[model samples]
Target chain A: SQTIHQWPATLVQPVGSPLSLECTVEGTSNPNLYWYRQAAGRGLQLLFYSVGIGQISSEVPQNLSASRPQDRQFILSSKKLLLSDSGFYLCAARGGPTGTYNEQFFGPGTRLTVL
Target chain B: AQSVTQLDSHVSVSEGTPVLLRCNYSSSYSPSLFWYVQHPNKGLQLLLKYTSAATLVKGINGFEAEFKKSETSFHLTKPSAHMSDAAEYFCVVSDLWGKLQFGAGTQVVVTP
Candidate 1:
């Protein structure tokens, strides 16, 4: 089993403020990490995914960026936050046997509110 | 393209009644379908999955989903609903690269 840890369960930021959300994992190594955003009344949107350290794939071009500094550390950052960026941000990792159709385990999630 | 559609945005059920969440997917090839549950203000938890192997998949907390290839549907059901079963459910389809396509969540309301 994998445990995902997300800090600052909730955040409130002003428009144009910089943003950063951290996600760390334990009980697994080199797991594929992903960042998703769930806007109110909308589905989850895939923002980014990392296969390994320093490798990131952006699913949608937006104001936010993701980085994998360590094997189990994934971070989501934004240079300037917008009101539209307010949403529930989730961090997930693919778990199970590699090269198989595995399910993702999610962290507690961070609720970001941009005013 | 691969995508998933959860038929209902919300469903209300009695505690002792059956539960059903309908989902349909679109893919050119055989897709890996999954059901995930999310509690209020919480993260996601995998309910069950249906790959090419089986049409019926059983998941945690006594939830199950049956995959119908003919209709391209993967619907989740529980024999009897519980208060704890009130949560949002998502229908997902996985691509070859392991990326998942999630459908709009269906919020279940279990009433006593």
Candidate 2:
């Protein structure tokens, strides 16, 4: 099992402000981490995922970017936010061990409301 | 390429009644499917998964999903609906290459 911690349960930002959301994982080593955004009426969309430290793969092309500075940390950032960025962002870590390998454990999520 | 479609955007059920959530998926090969539930303002939780195993997959909290390859369907069902069961459910498909494609969520409302 992987325990994920996300920061700033809620955020409100202006259209041009910079953005940063952090997710940290514990209880596993070299685990897979993912960032997803959930919009109203739509399901969660994979934004980026990291397999290891300093290795990030972007799933969707957008102004947003992701970084894995540490093995236990995944950060999502944007140089300039857009109104469309308003949504619920989630951080998930894939389950470890043999039986739970395919499952993912999620964080409480961060709700961003860009004005 | 893989994609998932949840048939309903919303479903309402009475307590102690049955709950059904329909899902259809498309993939190039035999894919891995999963069901996840999300409570209000909370994160998504894995309810169950089907990875080329038994056609009938039993999940957490008395939830189950039937994988019917002939129909390309993996429908989730629960015999008794609890108030806690009211949440947003997602149907997801995995390509085994680190990508989990998700479907539009279905919001379940349970009434007393």
Candidate 3:
């Protein structure tokens, strides 16, 4: 069985502060990782996705960016956070052999409140 | 282009009543559809998926969805509503590159 872990289940950051959120998957290698954000009373928005290490694709342009430092480790970072950056950040992973129907598995998520 | 539409933004149903959350999709090619549930302040959970093999797909917690290519619809249903079922549901469509396009989401409110 594979498990995904995210750090700082809840975070409170000041405006203009730096942000870092980490996600890691155990029991799987070379998985597809994704970063998503959900505002209050809204659906999810895909921020970034990575098919492999050092490869990241941005779905939407914003203050946030994602990086895949290692095969199973993904990080979401921002040099300076904005008030609009406050939301529930989620990490998801999908197993890959390159051509298969893979359903994404989500982590518990991190709630970031900017004040 | 691929897109998904969840018909109702919010749905209220009484306990013991049937549940229906409608969804329609548009895709250039044969698409993969999925339904995910999200509790308050929680991550989304996979409810069911239509991968072209089965027209009718059964998922966890007594939930099921049927895929209708003719109508371009994938609607989710349950025999009876439970209070535990109160949550937000999202309709998702996968494009050729496996990118998921999410709907605005439907909030299901099960009343006792």
Write the candidate numbers in order of decreasing TM-score.
Answer: 3, 1, 2
Best by TM-score: 3
Docking class of 2: medium
Candidate 2 Cα RMSD (Å): 1.9
TM-score of chain B alone in model 3: 0.98
The candidate scoring highest on DockQ is 1
TM of chain B, each: 0.98, 0.98, 0.98
TM-score of each: 0.97, 0.94, 0.97
Q: Which tens-of-lDDT digit does each residue in B24-99 have in candidate 2?
A: 9998888889999999999988999888889999999999999999999999999999999999999998765557
Q: lDDT tens string, model 1, B48-69?
A: 9987887999999999999999
lDDT scores in order: 0.93, 0.90, 0.92
Candidate 2 chain B: minimum summed lDDT over ten consecutive residues — where?
A: B94-103
Question: Whole-model lDDT for model 1 versus the true structure?
Answer: 0.93
Tell me how many clashing residue pairs each candidate has: 0, 0, 0
lDDT of 3 at A55: 99
Better of 1 and 3 by DockQ: 1
The sequence of per-residue lDDT tens digits that candidate 2 reaches over residues A1-115 is 6789999899999999999999999888877889999987677889998888898999888989999999889999999999999999999887454334277789999999999
Docking class of 1: medium
Model 2: per-residue Cα lDDT at residue A11: 99
